[model samples]
Target: MNLLLVVAAVLAYTVSAQQCSTPRVRSEWSQLTQEQKGLYVRAIAALAAKPASNQYANPDIMGWHDFVITHAREAYWAHGNAQFYPYHRAMMWQFEQAMIATGIWPSNMGVPYFDWPAMSQNWWTSDLFTEQYLGNMNSNDPDHCVLTGPFAKGKYQVAFDVDNRRAITSGDTTCLRRNAVQAAGDDATAIANSMNAGSFAQFTSSTSGSYYDTTNYHSTGHFIFGGEGGDMSNASVSPNDPIFWLHHGYVDKYWWRWQNQCEQFLYDYSGTLMSANDPNGNGIDAKASADQYTASWPFKVQQLLNTQGGDPLCYTYSKSAGDIPLAPLTCPPVVKPSVAPTTAPPATATGGAAATSASRQGSQLDDKWLYTALNLLVKQKPLGSWGNAPKTGATAAGGIQAADAGDVVVFGRRDLNETESFNGTLEVASATVQADETITGTIAATIQATATVMATTSAAVSEPIKKEQNAYIETINPDNSTTISYTLSNNTIEIPAGFTVYSVMPISATAINETSGKPKRFFPEIPKLEYVQHAEAPVNVEVGSHPCHLAYPILLPESYIESMGMNYNKYFNAHVRSKMQIDAFNADNCTTMFSPSSMMNFNSL
Candidate 1:
């Protein structure tokens, strides 16, 4: 039995090498040599030059636009649904094939990714928006056309209109446009929130919560670059922008990172065909399966799970700006059972408020004690709320301490400034199971915090400075086990006028148990928390500067509007006035605002 298990482990790990043999590595955009970039640019140009023949293709539209059209057609089904990750992964593979088919680039020329976190707050100055790369972020033209770069105006005619619904005829030509802005979720904080998600459901919700989830990199990545006139912002025709591939490449990398957390995650799949609230979804299965096919694609969700192992996905991500080294593709080593062994009860999860304990030796505390007390407090109190002082004789719902401890453990929110008054008697620390199996005993701990911000705008003394803050705690246990606790503190953020602030707070915890030499996760149910606070001084709008057109019904479909608790016709007038970019819309005094379209507008449908 032991030999058989060892053989199975070796077989599973070697499958990738046997199947792919030589996996192509996708590099960061800047990592590409000048010759590589030139080849890629030429390949894209070739795709854009050929006439499309697909059923969805428009008159005189290039082969490249075929992808944009397909993306638009499947937008409703592919996004805010269970297929978001898998579907995009398939699309990436397909585009790579198309690029190779163009005969301008080599098969090894995998699409490069833009690391949002690396260029987070300073995206405008990125090389991606330069003459040598994609193009200048914004255009002087009123239509916001790209006047430089390889895909400059008159070089590559854009096929779609502002809403990305209408395509031009043979005689008419439109230049690719850009209305750039600082995107949300481009910072490290947002990336941490995504990487720390415990389950696929939690991952999807935090990464792409419908169209309205600005905190997610998906929506913001498109919107900030796509701003009203830009093709990248519109969900349907976003692929029209060459930058779309790079953006999704990073997204794919993040999902890959999440899956590497455990062996189970590679097969982990769940969530409905579409958002449950979407009327079109009609309540399909909430749990997705590996056998399931991605929307509008022939590949199964299972095939897209692993970049190297997934069928037709034979590329690996090279160590780049916003990525980590790939985890080994080997199965865990098999361990033979001992003749006489002690077992620890399996860890169970429950949710609510968690408590924190500080040792008299400053920030150093006991790992087992902290985990037990926090888990205990969570079961009794509500999350994100302060725990009141516990009574002297009171005990938590599951009983105060583990079976071994004689003295009761009393804990709650104690005043930090209060004087310490503990008798010198040493109280024994205990957990539910043996010290080796389960956490037990009072062990030393060290807590460290690192902060990553989005944009920091310092104004004159009279004006308020715009600030966004996101924080998550990573605790290194005495046993070297790590617990990554995400705290979405229940506090309202205030954004001053003329600044954009994006913040995400983790309302729960996701911890990994690696002592056994295999990854095990403790995931408690963490509810989705949306906190959006925007404060701005109202400005008078000169409506005619930009056309006063309403968001098309197709763009803001009835089902989507209903999900957001908004009326189709009245939504713009009622909600957008206060939220729209006052500076961008006004054009004349719109220096503060990044672009003409509001974040909500970009997400409409």
Candidate 2:
């Protein structure tokens, strides 16, 4: 009995130690009381007015601008990679502390999120655009400068344009600019797709999107809120906008929701530190860990993972309209779609141009295609031997290539700032075509390539193309929570349900936002692509179809990967491609460009 009492005392002490005394609740903008909202805004103004603290260490900057500079300096490390979530989580907590320091808000008052999807359909008409809230949309302004509201032009002086490094260092000042626009990527389906990811590596990749991919909710949210020429659009200096805190608060809440789904996910952190767009010459694509320090923040990544774990992060997100669990769906086996067989057309010499259709089957391509057609001519080898090309003339091994492909005109999807559709071109002087059977036995056709063929293709075909079926079906629940379902790995995922069902959905209603009573004039007129209409994943394994290709050297050999005690199949499958293509290439006797054995040259890649 004495021993039991001693053990009970220790347990009680542990429980007491772990309990948080002043846990805060981060709410949606609509959820905040009028007084709370006023205080929140006042705190922001007060914080902006205060001088930068010595701890922040930015010379001649306001307290608020210090956060902006911190974010800008560490932007490269914070975005397009695994550090995205944890780094922002830490930044959010620090911003909260700074706001609390203003004395206008209560010590435990947490940041509020703009539940973007909830009001996304009618964001322009929402109370968020009022002078009392974030600011006016300023849709009519040529420069997209905020014209009225608390953050309108001249209301607050921006320290510098983060886009220009010199401007940042020189501390150039300007009025806030917000070219607010809507994006298909910032919808309920996109949010659901990201939240449904079963693993952290998948979650991070899907949620953040790759450096080359900007269709995901994270990138879209920024683009929509940041508008065309706004502070929020710039990843590095996004903190310049006060709304950045709220946006990140929503992101943290999403992470928190993902964390609560399972015990394993709470501290689950694994992904490469190097993003696809590696800017810093970081040779090591190091695996990310919770133990690592967050970008620009003093806290460790693990500490930032937990919201109620105290000291730095001690807040709970108020349950809002779209709050839902990450449902672990077990889908039924997939029935492979039968490809209709087509007889090869007879080679005819009756026309000025040969009409041919080449289809690419997979996402990753072998790098051997980097060689010029002259190289193939010198070797007198069929183009199919080099890469996944056809064995014939203009019809063979010919299709649009990605902009990054050597010496070719860069086209298709580009970074947000890029305006040019065509960059340059590759000129192949003269090439003789060889076909199995031709009208004249061995037809010698002279081919001259000038412009990027990819440029002439439709946007859907030029950029990453998504099969029509993978799109999410969003059902608005009677309770206001969204039931978004999508297919991943043959598993049809309907969040909150234990089972799965296959679905092919049309794009969600784009007109829902327009139905609101707001006059048409109130909305922003900024033009942008509808990513919702073109969400991408695994590519169709049609030769000459896709532009994005992974060089062979990047893939670790199956034997070597297995030797390290990792699943080689999982590593390969982890790439954003369909399982069918990955499976086909992994098999022996496959005669595709993705020859794993021949391509595995780690020694001299």
Candidate 3:
């Protein structure tokens, strides 16, 4: 079945097709004029009154809303993994096409996208929810159903979670339920991180994870708005929410922004190629492309990849600037240390948060003076391994004894403060120097600035930056350039040979000063893996949610076989191919779709 859709799409976008230039701009709901909003409502009403295609079991589609419900039913396979962006883009376009077909939509009007990230704080409560628009939260119904909306109870009866559930093999109708959830999931820093991610792999790795934090962009919106059992929470039926279209608009906009960053991003396709095995022997199984995606219109992943092409999806975003907050990174220049004035050489840059204090007794102090040349990697000062230490330095830190006992302090011949000149005792430390109060609340603000910038909603560093236990505190060098610390083990940690523990990198003074120079939003990057603490519990969405007749997926009518005078079972592949071509060939009336014998719903004659 997937191949059928791909073939249709390949034929639809012939080489001669015009590249979209005067593309319509999709804007926020609040930004729309009264006329536009009214057209949407009217179009919706017309679609509702139109007969439900009966492609699936529910014959009571009340109008265009059923298309939205049909999409909600298929929500299971729409998200998670990679095709999420492309799959949904195709789906929304189909929904728009349905509205347009009903003649309710204005010629220039495209589906409006809600710019959640771009809105001022507490956007859900905005005027976009007015009775003239999508309506407000229900005061009488505990499910938070919408009241006073055009689709209100008598105005429009819902059949599933909102209007229905995924499996609608029987009778089930309900009112539209909505709880406008205040989403603070993606803050400026996190969204900025996602937008600036270096590669698609990096972007995918970071965004699709299970970690629901303040930085997540796509899924977090669902979790934030879709409170327990709310229609938006369940992927199988999230489409029940009217605002779903708008939210996906923002998502599609993000893809557009990322794609326009560079031409190479146009072909950047990762994740799975084929979505599921075709239930229809005709080989029409769903692909990551468009078929079951939204009416399964002949749109492939590549066609939607770039919105500029005139191929069916020819819309553009009015505002390319993502609502994401910008957080800039600045790495300062490195400064070399001057030699010691006294006989003692510069103290080695020690390891742990707070390095051990200078030795008090002369013999122990002499032993401390013994040091070995440090091994350096391109980025880190590798304090992991060490060799024989030879006696070198003589001078000792002038600081008094009785340092914090519980704390590990590194005392050397001399340490250098940002202000103080080097060659003497410097109180240098690793994470703890920055960890005492830098808890989970502060973790998102401090991801490593230098690592591969994958925009992950990684569940890794989900835990707050509380005090890490059983970590290593090494006092390796005497130079104050930088210090390295490691996470040794947990309470049950058993150190294995050759196992490199997690490293803690302290920021350099120059870098710190450079970050502090401007607006003073200092984000020092930590270990990349350190951010991903765990894996999210995977939820595999079912292929087909409910029973259907036509087997056209979302495209064909039930009587396609008898009315077209063909044995659908005998030449299923050929029949499907012809139907696809016929649908595109005749954009209006969808005549070939409706078989006179198959038409049973009262809405359609």
Tell me model 2's lDDT, rounded to 2 decimals: 0.44
The local distance difference test score of each candidate is: 0.45, 0.44, 0.38
Among all windows of ten consecutive residues in candidate 1, which has the lowest summed lDDT? 353-362
Q: Which one is best on lDDT?
A: 1
For 230-333, candidate 2 gives per-residue lDDT tens digits of 67766655777777887788888878887776656766777755321121112123456665556444455666666776533577888886553334543323
Write down the RMSD of all candidates, one decimal each.
Answer: 24.0, 26.5, 29.8
Mark the 10 consecutive residues where model 2 has the least summed lDDT. Answer: 354-363
Which ranges in model 2 have alpha carbons more than 4 Å from their true place? Answer: 1-22, 57-62, 139-142, 162-172, 182-185, 206-215, 275-285, 324-326, 329-605
For model 1, residues 309-411, the per-residue Cα lDDT tens digits are 7344677787765442222343433332222222323222121110000000011122322332233223221111011222122112111222220111212
- Tens digits of per-residue lDDT, candidate 3, 149-241, equal 786645765533321232222333455656545533332222434545454445554222111111235554654455444555555456666
For model 1, the superposed segments whose C-alpha errors exceed 4 Å read 1-18, 55-62, 160-172, 182-185, 206-215, 275-287, 324-605
| Local distance difference test, candidate 3 | 0.38
**Each model's TM-score?**
0.49, 0.49, 0.46
Question: What stretches of model 3 exceed 4 Å from their correct place?
Answer: 1-16, 54-66, 69-73, 159-172, 183-185, 206-215, 273-297, 320-605
